[model samples]
Target: MRSLAGLAALVAAASVFLYLLSTHLPPGPTRGPPGSAEEEEVEEDGGVQEYRLKFPSDLDELRELAEMLKFYNREHHGYVLLLFCSAYLYKQSFAIPGSSFLNMLAGAIFGPWEGLALACLLTTVGSTFCFLLSSAFGKQHVVQRFPEKVALLQRKVEENRSSLFFFLLFLRFFPMTPNWFLNITCPVLNIPMPIFFSSVFIGLIPYNFICVRTGSMLSEISSLDDIFSWGTLAQLLAIALMALLPGALIKRYGEAHLKVDGVDSNGPSRAEVKPVRERW
Candidate 1:
């Protein structure tokens, strides 16, 4: 009950903050002319009513918003940064979609380097918030909901305890696993906060750079599919494989050494490997 209350308070506070912050943003694009399709509706009585339809907050709306903001970004750069970071964090903490659009917008408006930096920083911070939130209020529920997955992840964590950092890097660098799953499961697996932080920060760089660069080239992109061609995925997979190599090497060599020394792979240590006494 206490945890639930805390979660509620946190959500309420975030909502209020976002509401206040949004008040400062420039007005949305002006409505189209009176006879525009968006503003025209046919009534049952055969009369044409001008009823403007509000756009939902989705990729298309986000892109339109980004386009509107581009005109004012240079003059109100600081406010724009604050707005962008706040919106990104809110969406991430709540597991909302459309961050892909935000990533691209960042590149389009801020350019590649600045956009990448912002996206990376905001992503780490937002993901960390979600991690802490789940640790505090949602871990048990998530574990109960996905017991098999949790069990599998637990075994993987135990098996790779010595190479956990590299495992995390591989997970982040490759999008084979969803990041929200990692954020929620890491706490349940008892992964150290520092390891989680470092893995998320460092591991996401390559992928985020790709997203940001794609955003910078938004003008040329006809769809999201264009951003991640086979070539791009191959490059990302190559980097992920490289990240896993060091850990694999360490584990392989350690096992070989243990085998050579007559140490039980999963049992007693070298000290226990002694000759038996002749006397019964």
Candidate 2:
């Protein structure tokens, strides 16, 4: 109950912060010149609605919101940036889904290079915040709620302990991995904070780059399908495989050197190995 209450309070605080930020923004269509293609598209889609700060769920809504924010970005650049950072961090810290939309939005507003940099930085920082929150308030609840999952992840983490950073990189590279789960459970698995932070920062670059780049061309994209097409999936899979190479080599080396009937041939005995395994 205490954990839940703390989580709720944090969420409420974040919501209030967003509300305050939203209030500071001037009304929609405040700066852009008239009848441009961007303006025409926005007008055809029922004109700029009042700027309400929230997550955009689909392409049309994303386009509308992007257009609205772009208009605001012209005159209130600092506030727009702050609002984007705050919203990105809020979702990231809480493990909320739909960051792809925001990543693209960043691209639409900030352009490709800037948006990519921003996305990568915010993703790392936000995920780290989530890790810290989970460390402080979630370990007990996670273990209790998902005992089997916890045990499985604990075993996997131990198996990759020798090359844990590379293993984490592979997970981050693989698009299918549940990153939120990783963030929440990593502390419970005893992963180091430096490794966690570094992995998240370095590992998510490709994904963030893709989203930001697509966002840079937000005007051209038709749907999320355009972002995660077959070619993109292949690229992500290949990157994930490359990230796994170091870890696989480490595993193979350990097995060759240490696995002689489940004990090192010239070193530790079974009894000694027990202590080493426990030490992990």
Candidate 3:
């Protein structure tokens, strides 16, 4: 009876966690999804219009504006914004349209924390959408249409299921991992959704903050000097360096405590410790 109760509890907890991880973001004007008229990768008019550069001068004012948005958010029981963000991302991955523009627009709607939270949530949900689509289509279908670089992603996911969370983190940090590729193959790899989403939430949080803060800073940025501020680079680099810390620590500690002593070093046995060849 106790064992059954424990099992039931575990299942319920897992279910709840899954529900949270799979949550989506709410939608707003100008944000539809992937393949939507506005979000097309290949716009018939040529390329995406250059993002306009218009930022308010005062950061305090921007901060206050973000706060006001958050205040109004109180009326929703909670997570309504997150839901819209999630849905937008998921829909975008599917070609709903206007996703690119709205990704930036996310800065205006949700401030840093909420935007970061919702972005992380939505990115995971979007990845899952890709995963499902890829699973349905298969890799052969994926490679021929997409670029050569995409195939490598499929191979990595195939070989490295155990370290996928870390790999995903690295990819999200570097901004190199193709979200669509991961989306398509993860389900195919049979990676449990919870592990995938937890990684997404933790990994992409920094990137979301960057976008949100960048949006907030847009007004102040004018000249090239303002555009490439040293302080911003330093902060971003510091965060990036933090990701490498675990690797550095592992190497540093692993080598320091070489398990040599009682077990004997790899060197030849000492004369005292070595027995003379006996004629047994």
Measured by lDDT, the strongest candidate is: 2
State each model's C-alpha RMSD to the native.
Answer: 11.0, 7.9, 17.1
Return the top candidate by TM-score.
2
**Model 3 lDDT tens row, 171-244:** 55444444545565455446677777776666656555656555544433546787569976775576556555
Give candidate 1 misplaced runs (Cα > 4 Å): 26-59, 220-280
**Which lDDT tens digits does candidate 1 get at residues 179-202?**
877887788888899999999888
lDDT of 2 at 231: 67
TM-score per candidate, chains pooled: 0.68, 0.74, 0.46
Predicted candidate 2 versus true structure: per-residue lDDT over 1-280, tens digit per residue: 8988998899999999888887767655632448656566566667654556667999778888887777778877988899999999999999999889999999898988899899999999999999999888888887776555555556656777887887677667653337888898788888899999999998777778778766776655567896578865665566566556654664565455422232111322334332112112
**Model 1 lDDT vs. the true structure?**
0.67
- lDDT scores in order: 0.67, 0.75, 0.48
Q: List the residue pairs that clash in candidate 2.
A: none
Q: How many residue pairs clash in each candidate?
A: 0, 0, 28
